[model samples]
Target: MTATRRAAILIGVFFLLTEIGAIAARLLYAPVLTIPGYVLGSGRDPLVYTGVLFEVLLVIAVVGTAVAAYPVLARHNRAVALAYVTARILEAAIITLGTLSLLTVLMLRQQPHAEPGALETVADALLALQDGTLLFGPGLALGIGSILLASLMYTSRLVPRGIAVLGLAGGAVITLSTVAVIFGLYGQFSAIGLVVALPVFVWEISLALWLIFKGFNTAALERMPRRSVDAAGAEVAS
Candidate 1:
């Protein structure tokens, strides 16, 4: 296999692994958190630790996927590749913030003997930060990044336009939902956001599977840009 093709395959595998890890972590999280609360009166520490570990793993998986995919993207289109990298970095930052926010919330919840005024205010602020991070940060980054990456992939002939369209729609939903949350429209619209996000997650997982199992047709990859150049040259000569 060509180096580029090999890189693409590896990147595809990483993407698949990341998604699988995320799904697994999500599945395990509630059960683990509840166990501490149900069994022991003070499962708070265990739950928080588990949550932190899960978030750390999630961050690693995301970063690893981005690094693995970098070569393929760099080969196809530099601008798009940079954008992809930037988006992933932004995503990492969002996740980090989210993790920290959650940790803060956990700390506040686990406080043993409460203070009077200042500590209470600090805890309230932390809680607000947690809410803000959860409500907006990751979703915005993920949605915008997905749309940008999908557009690049479609334009570069790396994927189907339909996928790009779906990604674009998902980005729109995410952005709108975030706005709604900021504006205090969190009742019915938040549910709609969840509904919209489910298909997007499915689409991404399917795309990752296709990329890993089938790989891209290298022949098509080679022909696309060359044909574009040849056509352009012909126009110039005419």
Candidate 2:
């Protein structure tokens, strides 16, 4: 297989890995997230640790998808491809903040005879930080990046137009809905919020599977801009 094709496959794998890490970590973090004072009660530290590991890997995969896909995508539109990479990196950074907060909570819990009242307040603040990261990282950054990348794919026909349309639709819905939530029209964790997010979730999964099984459209590659002005005022083509 060509290197570009292999890169597409790797991107697909990273996409799936992100999903796995997100869901598994959420489930594993329930004890600390849901139970009151669990963080200081000799709680399920190991479980939360596993969740942290998953999230750390998730962050890696998030950046990997952008880095791996950039070269192939840049052939079509360098500006948009670069934007997508930037968005993914931003998303990863926000997620890293969330993960670090979780780690801090864990560290606080491990302290001998941790004070209950103070610990609870600090834990609540950390949880709020994680929630903010989720909202901005996945909800805003991912949504914007998806829209940009999907627009490129649609115009360039790198993948099926239908899949590209789905990506666009998903991004629009999630982004707009997130804004509504931010404005206090509804709670972010509400059922309505979940419903609106379905499209992006499906879009990601469908895109990942297509990349893994089908790779990029060859005709699209042939049609991509091959010549451009370099920084040194030299014309170059590949």
TM for every model, in the order presented, reads: 0.74, 0.95
Poorest 10 consecutive residues by lDDT, candidate 2: 37-46
lDDT of 1 by residue, 1-238 (tens): 7665676677666666656655554554443333422221233656456656776776776676667766555556656767777876777777678667556655555555655454456645654565565455456767776777677667766666676677667777776777776777664236776776675576567667667776765654775432122544541111
Candidate 2 lDDT over 52-72, as tens digits, reads: 999998999999989998888
Off by over 4 Å in 1: 17-44, 107-124, 187-189, 223-238
User: What is the number of residue pairs that collide in model 2?
Assistant: 0
Worst 10 residues of 1 by lDDT: 32-41
Best by the TM-score measure? 2
